[model samples]
Target: MEDLFYFKLFLAFTVGSTMVTLATVAAERLGSRIGGLIGGIPSAVAISLFFIGYTETPQLASEATSTIPLTMGLNGLFLVIYVGLARWGAWIAMAGALFFWVALAFLVILLNFNNFLFSLLFFILSLAGSYLILEKGYHLPSTEKILMPYTPLQILSRAFFSGSIISGAVYLSRVGGPIWGGIMAPFPTIYISTLIIMAKSKGVEFSRRITKPLLVSGMVNVVVYSTAVRYFYVLFGLALGTVLALGISAASTYGIYWFLKKRMS
Candidate 1:
């Protein structure tokens, strides 16, 4: 029954996320971030409800329900402004972007890249992520500069993040005794570093942005997932929770940009 629930949830997630991506593709001129929000809302609500249902503690449950919504809400606002000036035929731009990135992803996957792949990429992109918030006087020179220059970096970033997570997964498999230990392995380090970066970065109102509170929400689940493995011996659940938290944290950051966008406007 539990397995069935996860399977169904994944099916829904895939469908919903895909539809949202398509909406971004089809009507990019309509404002992609906004459209993406509209597209993503269904999945957000569904996943929100699922977490709300099983969350044992009242406080944690409240956090769970708001997690994805906060992300979408934040991302929506970011899109509204950043994409507001989008012109017609933006789909052509999007298609070009998609083609380039897919080819990039294929190359990363096939090459079996290493530390230069993940660690260096993280250091660099973490800086780029940092740039979006920091360096107020330094605006991106132009659209072409922002988009064109980022092509290789984008591929490198994806390869790195994916490899790091996979390495985490493989580490878990090797531990073999309890799932919680593996789940906990990455979080304390990752979360603390993220917090430092997010904390120090300027222009972001995440300090006041409480809706999704993803870093906190995600860290909570790491604990939950770890405990489930440590005490209850729910190894599989621990593994599932860690992976899910990874998705939530990374995706939700995009969500947060918008929430901040809305409030600022």
Candidate 2:
């Protein structure tokens, strides 16, 4: 049982890491908008929910799904903080953002909000509020130039780091229970990693540009995917439920990307 659990976690980690790395590379090759859209696809969320439902109970998985929107609300808070203070320095900005992430996450779990409808409402309001706070006077950079090409070592490192974060979050779900599990599900592994790299290489403005769309699109993906998983997990069982949830999430993401791209253009 123990070995099997570890194996599942390893599998999730691999999937999460690969997806994130691919998104990051795509963001580098394409533009920030495209990158943000891909980054918003909820790779970690999907992997965690499916494995949790598969290895644990569907109830626990549903409970975790219930909290994801709230957790994503908290993630919006993370981005707002990080972008607001990014001029100071990446480390300082990251520190301030993480402080809020931890605090907001704790507050949500303390409130013990379990209703899917209520959580979805909160998620929508929080996302809108956060976007308003961050989007004021925000403008995308005009040029699509790579500051630096990622070497093989850098790509591998990103994959390893993302994989480790996903693995850790899964392990934490067991220790912290479903609510805590859900709270940790949207840990900004990809966002923080990509932001740090961008900040260091491309500068704060570049990082901020990418972060705006990433947060907006990510919130949309989480809301839709979590809602689907919450309702369908028990009805269809883990495998089918996961497939349906991912399908909904993917379709939603594409629609959002189109809307966002059109609006921006």
Clashes of each: 7, 0
Q: What is the lDDT of candidate 2?
A: 0.77
* Tens-place lDDT digits, model 1, residues 165-212: 333423322233112112212322222222223333421232112212
- Which TM-score value belongs to model 2? 0.87
- How many pairs of residues collide in model 1? 7
lDDT of candidate 1 at residue 202, scale 0 to 100:
24
Candidate 2, backbone clash total: 0
Local accuracy of candidate 2 as per-residue lDDT tens digits, 158-180: 78877777676677778777877
Candidate 1 global lDDT: 0.31
Show where candidate 1 strays beyond 4 Å.
1-88, 114-120, 123-236, 239-265
Candidate 1 clashes between residue pairs 3 or more apart in a chain or in different chains: 71-255, 74-258, 74-259, 75-255, 75-258, 75-259, 78-258
Deviation in Å, model 2, residue 227 alpha carbon = 1.2
